[model samples]
Target chain A: MSNEHTAGPHSVGRRLIDLVPHIVLIVGVLIFAFPIYVTLIGSTWDAATIGRGSLPMTPGGEAWTNYSQAWSESHGERASYTPVRLMLMNSLIMALSIAVGKIAISILSAYAVAFFRFPLRMVFFWMIFITLMLPVEVRIIPTYKVVADLGMIDSYAGLAIPLIASATATLLFRQFFLTIPDELVEAAKIDGAGPLRFFFDILLPLSKTNIAALFVILFIYGWNQYLWPLLVTNSADMETIVIGITKMIGTGEAANDWNLIMATTVMAMLPPVAVVVFMQRWFIKGLVDSEK
Target chain B: MQRRVIFDNKLLPYLLLAPQVAVTLIFFIWPASQAVWQSVHIQDAFGLRSEFVWFENFTAILSDPNYVGTLRITAVFSLSVAVLSMAVALLLAALADAKIKGAAVYKTLLIWPYALAPAVAAVLWMFIFNPEIGSLGRLLNAMGYNWDYRLNGDQALTMVILAASWKQVSYNFIFFLAGLQAIPRSVLEAANIDGAGPVRRFWTITFPLLSPTTFFLLVVDMVYAFCETFGTIHALTHGGPGKATETLIFRVYQDGVVNNDLGASSAQSVLLMVILIVLTTIQFRFVERKVHYS
Candidate 1:
């Protein structure tokens, strides 16, 4: 390391080498942020400005008007319009339900698979694991049929439950459970703690970090879901913000409210991106660990 | 990996496993089996009766030139997305890996796009390349470039690819950063001592060392492009401009939902399932080998 400091001949090249990373990274960051910047700027402008096809790079005075229109009134395009607020609430419910539902179900299942001696345990585990291959897109028709038969359509249950059954979550929990020291379990047994007691007390507390990490991923996963929600909910009130924003756009660009649509886009992305940015460490940890 | 000290409750484990097992059975296994069964059978157009016709639907789909074209489109789309996203992410990750100030800021800014839904991502990109209201779109059109994704098939495909790759690059960036950071700094320093430039050191040392991560990301990204990009395609193109951007999964949605051909859709679903199984199996094998080696 010290040898490089004595070299005056290579100083210019080394300085250039140091500058290269900053230059490329700045360009990369700008490109990554450009769409977001454009959308954010578009959200504040009036529809007519956007409708006239003039690119408004600067913020407009219609921030309140555009946001209020997007949030309150259902534009006349669709017969029934869902208020963006209701859709946001619906998205929040669906995402939170999915995240909590998956964590609850998967933890118990992973507990059983990891800690209990039971018949067909591997069968149950493999059955859960096989779901990974059969993504809803592959089996969506039949899955929709099943949900319809269960009379869950147009309900929050329909939107969240089928998607909540997560193999990745179960696998993650199971892997974490396996790494728990056996002596802890033996000590729990000696303490006269039953399975449920140990699970609710010791095991749950031990899994706090994993649960938090998984929550970030699962919540984002739930919030970002488009097709499932699109398929299950035919009604306006049941529409998620993600689906509603797309529906607002319609097919052609002529009738669509560009300002309002961009506003809704910003609203739709807010919660999930906030989750990722706030819980970034956990999200990254969960992602890397789960992929492992 | 069985636990030495295990719970010995007979009914309790079943009780614990009930929710996941039941959901899996109803939502995943049953539907998947139904897809398989429906693929092997043909239903009448009247939605009344069906007959067992083993391999007939598969044969029909194989014989269909449109289906073959879809397969090719999917291959091209998936490969392009994977390559473009990975290359871009790898470059950004490498740049970030260099000793730079505010690297943390760079990473934080780069990764949040991972949280954007594919549909939302498509909508964001659509705003920019809308060929009318989009700034870039308006710029291109003003310059006499006939640019309408809704009208141009190739343009539509490009739009969808860019959107999909945009959404995915963050994921690959995170992984690549991890892989690069895991490389021993000492090794790179030693290479520098041996007269290797940065490019040579990266290719010979950093890249080879990062292959495991790269391989894993390749499989993951391919699968992502196949399945997850459905939202992007559905929102941006809807298999648009005469089915130019239709991937397999989107085709499955179009056929089953819009066209109402249950049997054919199920056949397509089954084919997708097979492809995924193969990809996943290869991934698992490589992962297991990596685990053993480590």
Candidate 2:
């Protein structure tokens, strides 16, 4: 690949042609970044500046005021005043719990299916695999009813538990486990290790990269959940930042604080975006591998 | 695909499987069955009385004009998003695959939007397109476009579609880029040595090879538009200008949660499940075919 580019004498026309990709990519990047740029600038201004039409492209003097207010106070005039701080905390907890819970349960289930000969193993595998077809939105009402019946609504368990069962994670782990050599199991047995001990010392250590990659994907998924959290949490204290930001917009633009909402939107995007950017290699691997 | 040497304990496997199986039954399998059951029953609004009316809810939903409209809207919305996002991502991916400088930096910048929540994506676009305060919205109004998505159905649908597609591009970009990268340079170089131009070579060589990835992404993008874009629609338009942007999933939510029309909602849920099942089957079949080819 590198030799092809270096083998030829560089012509002026060829040099110009080589520049096309860079120019196109820059334009693409700018267009993609435009919305976030606008929102960031808007978050720094007072509501009056934003509301008066023609939002300034430059940052204003109200950054501290807007962020502080959005962080501590209610946003919409008519809506419930769920502080962004609490909502961020709720979102954090929900994302972490869902990521960790899904990984833990899925690894166990995958280990069982891959390493053990048990009754109804295929049935259990099929049962878990079939869930890839049933998204939360499709079964919203009945799922809501189940949670309500269990008296789990408005709680963290309600927020995360129903969502923690993941077909993708299970399948990923199962696929990974199958690729492990049989010699490891024999070695563990020769060392007088029990099933749990082998799993802890051998399998768990081997699965670290897969687990981290899956964590990045699941964390974003859990954080971005809107409808499930919307249905289950009736109280303001339990509101996720994603749902909270929308509620801040409310029904009308006139009664809302645009700057505060913008600040919250920026804050809402920060963690997940940071995770993807920082853990990009794992995120990409998990996304591509999970689909396969 | 089991291990050669394995754990023989029956109780340990079940115990290990207990948590996942329990959650799947309680949350997934049970609610799914309930959706099926509720679909066949007509319940009064108050949860007071109910009657088993098999196939009646399905018949009514199928006959309802609003449901039909929603079905059309969903098809249009899903296809538009899939095509638009995939096209843009493919173009960008092709360019990024061109051995250009700063490709890694450009990729990092582009793929970060995959992490943005759909609802947050909606908020960002809504801020830009908000009629009174939004910069672009104000510009449109200034140009006598009368661009208020709040009052205009077409404008609302367009806005919702753009926002949804925007959020989805990074995801498609990552997959497309990977797909493009996966293609062997030897194939393209062979075509190049044959005096075939870049465009002809791309169409004849690159596209056919990329079809499996394209097909996979098509299903994924469609599924995304169908169900996952609920937050985008809910936040941006709330399926309004009088149900203009109401996709099938939003209608289910509207009927079930917002309106408390349980019977209709459950019927819709059942139908949606069937649609998703069909989509999943198609995806799996294609995946299996691809695996065999490889």
TM-score of chain B of each: 0.98, 0.97
Can you write out model 1's per-residue Cα lDDT over B36-118, one digit (the tens) per residue?
99999998878799999999999999999999999999999999999999999999999888878999999999999999999
- Lowest lDDT 10-residue stretch of candidate 1 chain A: A74-83
lDDT of 2 by residue, B153-187 (tens): 99999998899999999999999898888898998
Candidates, DockQ: 0.83, 0.85
Query: Candidate 2: misplaced stretches above 4 Å?
Result: A1-9, A74-80, A252-255, B44-49
- Fraction of the reference Cα-Cα interface contacts (below 8 Å) that each candidate reproduces: 0.83, 0.90
Model 2, span A78-193: residue lDDT tens: 44458889999999999999999999999999999999997799999999999999999999999999999999999999999999898999999999999988888898898999
Lowest summed lDDT across 10 adjacent residues in model 1 chain B is found at B126-135
TM-score of chain A of each: 0.94, 0.94
Clash counts per candidate, in order, are: 0, 0
| lDDT (10s digit) by residue, model 1, range A1-292 | 6776776437888778788888888898898899999999988887778777785788888788878877888573333357899999999999999999999999999999999988898999898888887778778899999999999999999999998788888999999998988999999999999999999999999999999999999899899887799899998889999899888887847546787888889999999999999999999999998887
In DockQ terms, which candidate is top? 2
State in Å the error of residue B69, model 1: 0.7
Distance (Å) between predicted and true CA of A18, model 1?
1.4
Candidate 1 segments exceeding 4 Å error: A1-13, A76-80
Residue-level lDDT for B59 in candidate 1: 97
